[model samples]
Target: MSLAETGISDAPLILGSHTLRSRLIVGTGKYDTLELMQQSLEASGSECVTVAVRRERLYDPTGRNLLDYIDFHRYTLLPNTAGCYNAKDAVRTAKLGREILLGLENPGADWVKLEVLADTKTLLPDPVETVLACEQLVELGFQVLCYTTDDPVIAKRLKQVGATAVMPAGSPIGSGQGILNPNNIRICLEYLKGEDPDYPVIVDAGVGTASDVAFAMELGVDGVLLNTAIAHARDPVRMAHAMRHATEAGRLAFQSGRIPRRLYASASSPEDGVIGRTRQDRTSQ
Candidate 1:
């Protein structure tokens, strides 16, 4: 189905200075081939794509670079500090990305996807370090999109530190466990909207399928950022298409407003309908 048919036309979605046509944000990793990656991204209808920065590989001619395949004019490149361990590392990497990837044209590098992992096992954000980095980055004139946990307190702190959006993980990176704690995500959403109604809340990692994307949108999330789920799928291109559709469906469902759950049966059929009547009558059968 088309995005319009799915009812995504009304969701308030924005990224940096550009307004996105689709609420779903896709990643540019894990594709088997660059051609497939392009197809998947196009099918996903994502206006923004995330790309990781590594210092050692910056000059590698044969290495895969997002700029090599993606048309920069068409998509906004959201460079990320993926493997950084602390605020300093993240800031340094972000600065390099701004110079090499974003270039002099978009000198500000306006948006930075901040990820500072505390541990290698779970890849959870260290709130202390993350907040420190966020404050520094914001002061440096960058629009910080922080990757964080689903804790309401951490989210609040991130916002207070000048995060443009608070991205809480559904689970660990690449776990594909879907949303581990719906209540926490809901609380994060509540806290964000309450504190700054315009601040965006994006679901960042552990999204396994289209349903996970849909669930996040339905929860009033502004957007989603995922990678491994689509890239590692059996057919990555097809999975990308599914992700796009799922996000649109979820956004539409939210805008329309879901029905309230009830303990007792409440049928849509008319309560005054005749008990039992057939056009053929009882004797006919």
Candidate 2:
């Protein structure tokens, strides 16, 4: 069935307490300016945006804060632990994010995007540290969206540890490799959502363009989380618009169901019915 026939609310992406309409989650980093970021975000049609708790000026003393530009009511402020290299630091950052946002009247204040990197050079997530931090954050009453490698075992582990969402990277951070191992991603999705089909398995990072985002969505992931791809584009706003449509298109194609491939070609016209030749013509020939 077509998505239009089913409707927009047919399968909403539910993260924590929020039911999000848009599947694409953008990041509020790497943009040249706040104004540009706002424009791009609007164009992207993203309901949730990740903001680095460490880098953003949540409360600027000079009356110039990142929060000043963002409309808290319009978008979900998903605070992330981007720079943390260990479980302790990541947990600390998450706590700080909660403390900072609890004062604000936003529903996403309790949710955190957890990432514990092994090193700066690789920018790959530390599986052990990520799982550890997720456990602590879940215990602390925070809805944790874990960013980890595309490993089925680790994804299941994260879910077991109470991660609200399992975001497996398409590739290394900032590499833009774009789903280096689709098979691995598929496995992660299957294992995590084996029993619960609605389980959120988002593809985070390594998306270089609109096609990449579409492809990821085609894989039946619940959603996508990206930053640099749009932020670094020459025309960020236009790219954001493309991504928005691409995500919808990909999702619609998946829902509509694609036909299976065959080794031999099949004729569209009926073999029993003839348009140009009749029985008399065949006998004369």
Candidate 3:
């Protein structure tokens, strides 16, 4: 049976103008080999794969590009301004990626992952430049997905400036911390999804394991986007499978509606419903 046949997924993830089958978005870098990356991506169950447009060594010494291994028809490429520290450079790289994808006749030409970094050390998005780039990209008729910090105000500002999707970081990029501040993420969801409940708010970065993906999903995010969690794992394929299952489980759990937390313990089986001596025992109590 296929994974979809398991009846786990609820609805398709409508990201920007694209309708993605899986809620997990995987990155197309950091793998040891192109073949490994391909295998891991296949295992991830993600319909969209993000690639860094800047400083990503697209072409190797053998003149073989990373795009050669990817199946353009199967995966929609979300080009990202990974290394751009300013809005102008990010916009230029985004345009370059669109041109390149358009030349390839791929449907991903209309969309871009806008990431204007604050600095080299933190790899956090420069909130101001990111917003500027997002506005510019939207003006250019591009579906801009802004990668920002876990700040709810910043996320709100991005949505206000016409960002198609606002991807708030779970924690520092590639930190393996895994949703260090879920309360902040919760507020991000509350603020972003206030009026538009279907608005896609993906938790990007700082996902170390499958549980992290599940936790983010349980927090009511539309999706979880990660790179190092799967790519840098001991076994990328295995990790991919784990993340896929986690995504499904988390979404299902959220839909199921968990019981509220309590300080005191509650009885599993009620006293009134107990078998033989249950009524008498309850009366005595």
* Alpha carbon lDDT of each predicted model: 0.85, 0.90, 0.91
- lDDT, residue 57, candidate 1: 67
What is the lDDT for 40 in model 1? 86
- Once fitted onto the true fold, the runs of candidate 1 whose alpha carbons sit more than 4 angstroms away are 5-8, 56-64, 104-108, 275-285
Off by over 4 Å in 3: 1-3, 6-9, 55-61, 270-285
Which model scores highest in lDDT?
3
Please provide, for model 3 over 1-285, each residue's C-alpha lDDT reduced to its tens digit, 9 standing for 90 to 100.
Answer: 655698655789998779987999999889999999999999999999998775555557677688899998889999999999999999999999999899888889999988899988989889999988999999999999889999999999999999989999998889889998999999999999988999999999999999999999999999999999999999999999999999988888888898899999888776565567766677786
What would the TM-scores of all predictions be? 0.90, 0.90, 0.92
| lDDT preference between candidates 2 and 3, better one | 3
Ranking by TM-score: 3, 1, 2
Name the lDDT value of residue 170 in candidate 1. Answer: 93
User: What lDDT score goes with residue 155 in model 1?
Assistant: 95
Model 2 residue runs over 4 Å out of place are 1-9, 55-63, 268-285
Query: What is the overall TM-score of model 1 with all chains considered together?
Result: 0.90
Model 2 C-alpha lDDT per residue in residues 29-58, reported as the tens digit of each score: 999999999999999999999988765556
Q: How good is model 2 by TM-score?
A: 0.90
Distance from true location, Cα of 243 in model 1, Å:
1.0
